[model samples]
Target chain A: MELIAERGYRRTSLAAVAERAGLTQQGLLHHFPTKELLLVAVLEARDRWDLASSAASAAGSWRTGTLAQLVDYNATRPGIVQTYTVLSADSVTEDHPARAFFESRFRAVREAMAAVLRAEFGETLPGGLTPERAAPLLVAVMDGLQLQWLLDPQDVDMPAAFRDFVALLGRGGD
Target chain B: MELIAERGYRRTSLAAVAERAGLTQQGLLHHFPTKELLLVAVLEARDRWDLASSAASAAGSWRTGTLAQLVDYNATRPGIVQTYTVLSADSVTEDHPARAFFESRFRAVREAMAAVLRAEFGETLPGGLTPERAAPLLVAVMDGLQLQWLLDPQDVDMPAAFRDFVALLGRGGD
Candidate 1:
């Protein structure tokens, strides 16, 4: 994952992954037959890790606060986040192996965010924005902030910026 | 630019660029001594295109309105935007050739955005958010929205979401 994060999907060869994991190419192939399968396993592992961490942090519930916690958590683990950022952007192109995974992941994220907004703010948020309307904005800010923060950590305060956004959403609603 | 946008920086070769542009490799190298130089020129050309288009549409100025217009304009030119998206993400790697260029570009962008916010809102925006603070968010949303829109244009209304963000910034400030 660290190798993939630093080098990106196209550059991170199976040999590198095997080397990183202290396995021969043949040894690695014992567990995963192809690079695509290995990539899928890596992604699934990331999802599992995120879910486990979220569940632990939020006492088995993931809400807006938990989401904020996740952002804070991401700030501490730049490598994992970088892996995600790089892969997600790479997946935007047609025929990329990770395209469908990202597509479904984003759909799930938007829906999860909308559910959280609905729970926290009832139906409408400040300035008459629906949960559905605000959900994409929420996801956009999170991902967008990650890009800036990654590029210039000294300039972009990921956690504080996220907090400011949460405050905005928590402000006066119609 | 279209090829780079599709295949990203690492995969794009000078030969491919030469073929795409109907020039020999030597002919291309006459203008850009190296691939790195060519990449820089491409980025600069993109900035020029954006500035020229923004100036024409916004009457020789760039405000939040112009920024929104740029987003609308970007939707119409997915190739350039995708090139930007892919390259920007790839550039996040510490050793990427475009890293310094992106860093400086972001710094200038943040400063420009700060000036714009300060001009429009006079020092502070709603919720006491300084222009310095809000500038990153503005830039983040623009870039972030591009990612989401690129992934699923049918679902993500990039312009409308941007307008909503501008509205958020405009509301209830000192």
Candidate 2:
């Protein structure tokens, strides 16, 4: 991920990644047969890390739940956010390997979040905001907030903005 | 822009841009001194086009205006949006030329939007819902929606979602 950050994904080779990881090229290749595969592994690792961190944080509180923690987590990891932004934009085409990974990652994340929201609000949510609708809106806001933060981190009070947004969601009904 | 879209940006050259634009290599060089300059020009052209198109659509009807139109315009121009997203992410460092372009572009767009929003809403907007705050949120939502739409156009009803959000914004103080 650091290699992809410093040198772009295309420029960062297996040897470079191995050197950065303090492993021999052969050792790295044993794990990831190709650069594309290695990139996927990196993405998967990030997704797993985020999910684990979010889950751990969620376990601690019901009042200040996963949504708040997710916002905080995003605030701290601008690099990962930027990398995802760049890669996702680049991976728009049908055949891009990263596209599938991102698509599934996004779906899983949305579903997980929707489950949390459902658990919190239950039938109290006005008109009963379906997970499908609420999930996408939440994800869209987060993604959008990240872009705003990237453009001007100082200008965007990300956690506060998200907190306000979630508060509105809790009230439900536009 | 098409050349870069077809063959990724780094792989596409000044020669290719010239060929696509129906200009001789010398002719292209006469207009743009370097590949970077050409890329900038492409971005500038897109900016100008978007501004003009948005301005035309936003010309009349101060209140109850069509935010949906704005969303639709962006949805149709995925190429321009992708170009900006890719360049903006790459331009994280202060020294990158595209960084300045994006910063200026964002500022200009936000300011323009604030003016429009103020005109539309007058003083009815709630406390803390100033144009400055609202403008960035609007841009963030637009950007966020675009990312989601690009990933799965079928899943997102861009204009409807935006309208719902805007309606929520209008009903201030939650």
Q: What are the Cα lDDT values of the candidates?
A: 0.81, 0.68
- Displacement of residue A81 (Cα, Å) in model 2 is 2.5
In candidate 2, what are the lDDT values of residues B67-162, reduced to their tens digit?
Answer: 567577767666656665556656664356676677777778777777767776654444346666666667777777666676677767777777
Question: Per-residue lDDT tens digits of candidate 1, residues B51-124?
Answer: 76665435644578877887888888776677677777777865778888888988998998898888777776
Error of 2 at A2 (Å): 6.5
Q: Score the docking of each candidate (DockQ).
A: 0.49, 0.36
Candidate 1: which stretches are off by over 4 Å? A1-13, A20-22, A30-40, A55-60, B1-13, B20-22, B33-37, B56-61
Q: How does chain A of every candidate compare to the true chain A by TM-score?
A: 0.84, 0.77
Candidate 1 residue pairs that clash: none
- The DockQ-derived docking category for candidate 2 is acceptable
Q: Report lDDT (Cα) of residue B36, candidate 2.
A: 61
lDDT string, candidate 1, A1-174, tens digits = 788758765677899999999999999999988776687778789878888766544564467888888889889877767667777787776677777887888888898889888888889787788888888889989988898888899989999998888777877677
Q: List where candidate 2 sits over 4 angstroms from the true fold.
A: A1-16, A33-37, A55-64, A123-129, A172-174, B1-13, B33-39, B54-66, B93-95, B122-128, B172-174
